[model samples]
Target: MQQIILQPQTPDELRLVKQFAKVMKIKATTIKETPKARKKREILDGIERGLAEIKLHQEGKITLKTAQQVLDEL
Candidate 1:
C-alpha cells in the first residue's frame, strides 16, 4: 500500500478531500501537531522571516532593529 499526504489550505478544501476519500473508500486521518513540532515550526518560520528581513536590509529597502534594540524589545 502506498501513502499519500494532502495539505489542504482551507476548510472547504479539507472537506472536499474528506468527501472524496470517503467516496473512494480510502481511510483519511488528521495528524495533529505536537507542542514540540509546533515550536520547531515556529522557530523555522522565525528564521525564514529573519533571513528575509536581512535581505531587505542589505537591499536598503528596510532597516533592521539593532541587537540592543532587539534585546530591549525582548
Candidate 2:
C-alpha cells in the first residue's frame, strides 16, 4: 500500500477530505504538530535557553542589567 499526504487550502476542503477518507477506508493520522507547531517548539526552546541564562544570572555567574540599561549601552 502507498501513502498520500495532503495540504488542503481551506477549512471546507479539510472537512471534505476527512469525510472522503472516512468513506474510502483510508486511515488518517491528523498531525497535531505541524509547521506552525515546529515554530512553536523553536520558540519554547529559546525560552528555555533564556531561562537557563536567567538561572545563571541569579547564581551570580553572570551580571546583567535590565532591558533599559542594555538599551542605554547601545
Candidate 3:
C-alpha cells in the first residue's frame, strides 16, 4: 500500500481530510509539527552532529576541514 502525507493549511482543512480518510476506511494519524518546531528540530540535529564531529576530531578519529578549505569549497 502507498502512503500519503498531507500538510493542511487550516484547521478546517485538516478536519476535512481526516473525515475523508475515515469515510474511505483509511487510517488517519495526526503528527503535529509547526514550521518553527521543525526548524528548531533541524537546528538541534545539526548541533548534535557538530558536537559528535568535534569529539571525533579531538580523538584523532576524524579530520575536519579547515576554515580556508571550507571557504574554498563554498
Candidate 4:
C-alpha cells in the first residue's frame, strides 16, 4: 500500500481539500436502500387508490367514454 500526504498552502485550498475528503469518504461507504415506514405507507396508498379507480371503472361508476373524452381534452 502507498500513502500520500496533502498539504494545502492557502485557506481556500484547505477548504477544498476538506470538501474533497468528505466526498471521498461518502463515496467509499456502502449505500443501502432503507425506505421509511411512512414512505412505504404512501406507496401502498397510491397502489390502493389506483385499484379503486379500476374497480370504479369496471362497475360503470366512471364511464369509459367520459374517461376518453377527459383524456382527449388533455
Candidate 5:
C-alpha cells in the first residue's frame, strides 16, 4: 500500500488532518465491495427515477391531476 505524509505547519492544519484521517478510516472500514455496492446503486437509481417522474409531472409532461391522484393513492 502507498503511504501518505501530512506535514502540517499550523495547529489548525494538524487538527484538520487528524479529523480528516479519522473520517477516512471510518469510511474505508465501512466500504462495501462490488455486489453490495451494486445493490446500493440500484436503490439510489430508483430514488432518482422517482424524483425525475415527479419533476416531469410538475413540468406538465404529466398532468397535475394525475400526479395528485398518484400521491393520494400513495
Candidate 6:
C-alpha cells in the first residue's frame, strides 16, 4: 500500500478532487499541520504522549499478549 499527496494549484481544483473522492467512495481525509510557530511544542507534546503510554504499560496499567497484534495492525 502506498500514500500520495497532492498540493492543488487552486481551491477550485482541490474542491473537484475532494468531491470526486467522496463520490467514488474513497477513504480520503484532510491533514491539518502544526503551524510553524508551534512546531517544536507539537513535537514535544507527541513525545510526551508516547512516553505516558509506555509508563502506563510499565506500571502494569496495561498488558499485551504480543507485539505482533500491534504490528499486524499496520
- Against the hidden reference, what TM-scores do the models get? 0.59, 0.46, 0.58, 0.38, 0.40, 0.41
Candidate 5 lands at a TM-score of 0.40
Poorly placed runs, candidate 6 (over 4 Å)? 1-34, 64-67
Candidate 1: C-alpha lDDT: 0.92
For 10-47, candidate 6 gives per-residue lDDT tens digits of: 88998998998899998788765568836986789899
How high a TM-score does candidate 3 get?
0.58
Cα lDDT computed for each candidate against the true fold: 0.92, 0.89, 0.95, 0.71, 0.72, 0.82
Top model by lDDT, which number?
3
Q: Per-residue lDDT of 1-74 in model 3, one digit per residue for the tens?
A: 99898988899999999999999999889998999999997999999999999999999999999999999998
Model 4 C-alpha lDDT per residue in residues 1-74, reported as the tens digit of each score = 65555656687986787788797883322223367855896899999998898899999898455677889999
CA shift of 42, model 1, Å? 0.7
How much RMSD separates candidate 1 from the native structure?
3.3
Taking all chains together, the TM-score of candidate 2 against the true structure is 0.46
After TM-score superposition, the amount by which residue 47's alpha carbon in candidate 3 deviates from its true location, in angstroms, is 0.4
Error of 2 at 44 (Å): 0.5
Per-residue alpha-carbon lDDT of candidate 2 for residues 1-74, written as tens digits (9 for 90 to 100):
89887878688998999999999998997765589887997999999999999999999999878999999999
1-74, model 1: which lDDT tens digit per residue? 99998878799998999999999999999887799998998999999998999999999999887889999988
Ranking by lDDT: 3, 1, 2, 6, 5, 4
Q: After superposition, how far is residue 41 of candidate 4 from its true place, in Å?
A: 0.2
Model 1 weakest lDDT span, ten residues long = 5-14
For candidate 6, the 10 contiguous residues with the lowest summed lDDT are 29-38
For residues 14-58, could you state the per-residue lDDT of candidate 5 as single tens digits?
678778879778332223248987799789999999899889988
Candidate 1 residue runs with Cα over 4 Å from true position? 1-27, 71-74
